[model samples]
Target: MTESDLIAALEDAGVHVVFLPYPKPGSYWHAHQLIVIDARLSSRWQRCTLAHEAVHAWYGHEGPCAPETEAWVDERAAGLLVTEQAYARAEWLHGPDVHAIADELDVTPWVIEAFQRTLRRVA
Candidate 1:
């Protein structure tokens, strides 16, 4: 979903979302019961960040403190914003370039890179 659609979904789910001048794209501020997204980030990055934080919200908190948790969450977030099947289609159309794939997917290169890593592992 797009950034606005994700925000609306989060709100409808009783999750508070706020955009402010933060350095990072997103953070799940459990103490405040809200998700904070960087207002300065591009819409695509914002959407990806929301997707990431939304997973945390879905689980009611961050996962257990383990090194793999973040990586797992990253993969899930990327897949959430751009489904694996959609990424495959975009990859076919865009070739095997991370920047190009990210551009096509409307996400940051970092997320694309993470998704690519997952693809490599699965292949």
Candidate 2:
């Protein structure tokens, strides 16, 4: 889904999204049902961050997540943002370069990495 679609989904789920000058790329406050994205990030980063935070909200995380939770969130968010078909097509076109694949898919390298992890788990 697009950034707008993600925002709409969050709103529909009673979560609010806001852009602020945050130190981190994005954060989800479960208690407040709010997602805050660092206003300074580029659009690509913002979109990726939004997806990551949305997964946290979907899972109803209360505070800071543990490493395992963060990993799961990354995988889930990567799945939400990039489909397997698209990833495969990007890889076919761009080879195994993470940056090239990410550029082709219009997602962050982190998302690409997470997607790779997901693919590994499935395989």
Candidate 3:
């Protein structure tokens, strides 16, 4: 979906989103909320990152300066975008490789796998 569409989705879910300039430091900020994004990232990365971070807020995730936890956070965020249903449909409907599904969804292949894991976790 386009950035506007993504923003609209967040709004529907009752989250506020703002685009801001990236910090002087390097690296694209995926999202944070209000400060949801550092804003340096291109629009493409912006939407993907936004979806995940917004999910964090929704999930009320708490913590800081933890590597192992960051991986878990990444899964949760990715799960929000690459939802289980979407992943399954993409996998079954496409009837081919995972990369094709990722390409179709405009998300990373890891996202698709994470979505599957999320489904498994919830199920």
lDDT per residue for candidate 1 within 55-91, as digits (tens), equals 7776667534465776777887777777788798889
Candidates, ranked, lDDT: 2, 1, 3
lDDT of 3 at 37: 68
Selected candidate, larger lDDT, 2 vs 3: 2
Candidate closest to the true structure, highest TM-score: 2
Compared with the true structure, all predictions reach lDDT values of: 0.80, 0.94, 0.62
lDDT of 1: 0.80
RMSD of each: 2.4, 0.8, 4.9
Q: How many residue pairs clash per model?
A: 0, 0, 3
User: Global lDDT for candidate 2?
Assistant: 0.94
Clashing pairs in 1: none
lDDT of 2 by residue, 4-120 (tens): 999999999999999989998988889899999999999999999999999999889888879998989999999989999999999999999999999999999999999999999
Off by over 4 Å in 2: none
**Pairs that collide, model 2:** none
Number of the predicted model whose lDDT against the real structure is largest? 2
